[model samples]
Target: MGYGLAVLGLLLVLSGAPAPAQTRAQTQESNDAAEQELRLPPIGSPAAEAMARYAIEREKKEYRENIERAQEVARLSAELQKAFEQRHGLFPDDLRKLERIEKLARRIRSEAGGSDGDDEGSDLPKSLEQAVRRLANVAKDLSERVEKTPRQVISASVIEKSNELIELVRLIRRLS
Candidate 1:
């Protein structure tokens, strides 16, 4: 009877004993899981709501700024067209105007979630006159596209038009 009791106790002790390797691995995994859970606030929590609101506000502000930039681009393009009409060639401030247009176009593209796209070998203007006219037309079109695009939507057409306008501005700058 004493020997049988000793054997049963031994079996229970063995069963209860945790393997060192498995215990260590399980502990580490649980710790990592807990750390990951701590990183993000629970869904529907106040912290999550605040984070969402912040993101929405930031987007709204960016949209407003982009609209202003688009308006500026339109105004500058109109002025460039008028200057070209008056001077009949590259004006004194034509380079500056082209540079501004390029900068604005790049900003608009980035804000509209566009990357720098490759020039698709579109028909480039050859002469300074042709380049200036094309730049005006492209800039006007880009501005219109931006104004028409909704705040929540990223328009592929806006991105394409901005890229085209940027390329046209660069070409005009080179031609001048």
Candidate 2:
């Protein structure tokens, strides 16, 4: 008990007495840091303040322009889609694929037609769904025609590639 008490006393004494020089050195180091910070240009410096303001304004301008460009792209694409539908009765690429499906991994996007600006898995907006369903019907008809005519399947049909596209659609449907 005496030995334990002696060890506890020693610990308490050591803890209670921090070397004075350590405190002095710490204060001097803090003062040096403060002096360095003070030597830097204050916010009152016109050039530094102007540069900061300019950077902020430039960033704001860039953000605004980006938004405007995205909106313009959406508008233009919608216009192009309408034109394509009017002139060709379906997506232009779909028409091309009907004519020749080779050398093109079926550019038919998951959503179909031009970009409608929908995020991934955003429930496939009703209009986009209708368009995709329409294309699916077209693909189904083509698949049937190819099956009916074996020689045509070898000659007129893009069987292997179309099969891949059909498989991809099936996978996407399962995922959604």
Candidate 3:
């Protein structure tokens, strides 16, 4: 009788234990349900429509801001180029322009999805004039690239160019 009772208790305990496969299936189902709950509403639903409109408006605003920053970069670079041509080297007063160019380039780089990181090595310009000229050319290229890129796109080339322009501006600032 004791042996039969012990066997019955063990059977009950074994039956109550959840099987690993069954537990995993339950967890997967729970995860799927949670994911479904977090998903966007179906297309044509009011919530979905509102989300779409908001996304479009936000994209348009970002696009306008990007264009403005790129244009400012071009203008500042051109001014630097002109100053160099006139004086043959940057004057103390021209440091402000370089600072502004650096600021604008930083903003443009961030907006284009770039992070502050060491740029790939390149030969440093031998003179202030050469650096300024390179800066002007790069700024122009950056402006054109930004204008050509669609609002929905994140451009690697634009980010690379911005980094290059920023480094040149910094080098010029330090040398001046």
Candidate 4:
């Protein structure tokens, strides 16, 4: 072989380019990388391992969730305001003034939440299907809390998007 070819052949033999052998350390490293990606705890650790647990916990029990929920409520309120303006050039005269409507909105929202702990499943009105869907999603999320591991995390930042959807539901209910 030529000098270059000789060197190439020697390098290929040393590198085992024709055949592959995975060392134990290389295998362990690959496994570790996978575990990290999955948020799995090490062989021996006291703390929780998975990120999903944190996400579920943060979304409900944390202040971040409350803020997000409050923001969603604000967005729904804005949409209702806009729809009212579009429909009647400001709020309806019979719906009461802004301040009173705000008070009623708070009362009703609190009542809705408080009523969740009660027997709401039996008394949901058939006419409020749209409202029920939105509220069902909220309940679905809130009910999925992590009991063992709770940490603050945010999911998808989807409150605004949900707000737009709920706005349509709120409008439908107001009309019905």
- Top lDDT hit: 3
Candidate achieving the largest TM-score: 1
Report lDDT (CA) for all predictions.
0.81, 0.43, 0.87, 0.43
lDDT of 3 at 8: 76
TM-score preference between candidates 2 and 4, better one? 2
Q: Estimate the lDDT of model 3.
A: 0.87
Per model, how many backbone clashes are there? 0, 0, 0, 0
Model 4 clashing residue pairs (backbone): none
Residues 35-73 of candidate 4: C-alpha lDDT, one tens digit per residue:
889775553455453555666666455544444444444
Give lDDT tens digits, candidate 1, residues 1-176.
Answer: 99998887788668965444457778678889999987978889999999999999998898888988888888888788889889887766877877888889889988888877633556887887777777777777887788788888888888887888888887777776
Q: Candidate 1 — which residues are off by over 4 angstroms?
A: 1-38
lDDT of 2 by residue, 1-176 (tens): 99998887788668865444458778678889999986746677987788789988885665444333323323333443455456644455543432332112232221122122322332232353344443344344444433344331232233332444344333333433
Which 10 consecutive residues of model 2 have the lowest summed lDDT? 107-116
TM-score, structure 1 vs. true:
0.72
Which 10-residue window in model 1 sums to the lowest lDDT? Answer: 16-25
Error of 3 at 121 (Å): 2.1
- Regions of candidate 3 where Cα sits further than 4 Å from its true position: 1-43
TM-score against native, each model = 0.72, 0.32, 0.72, 0.25
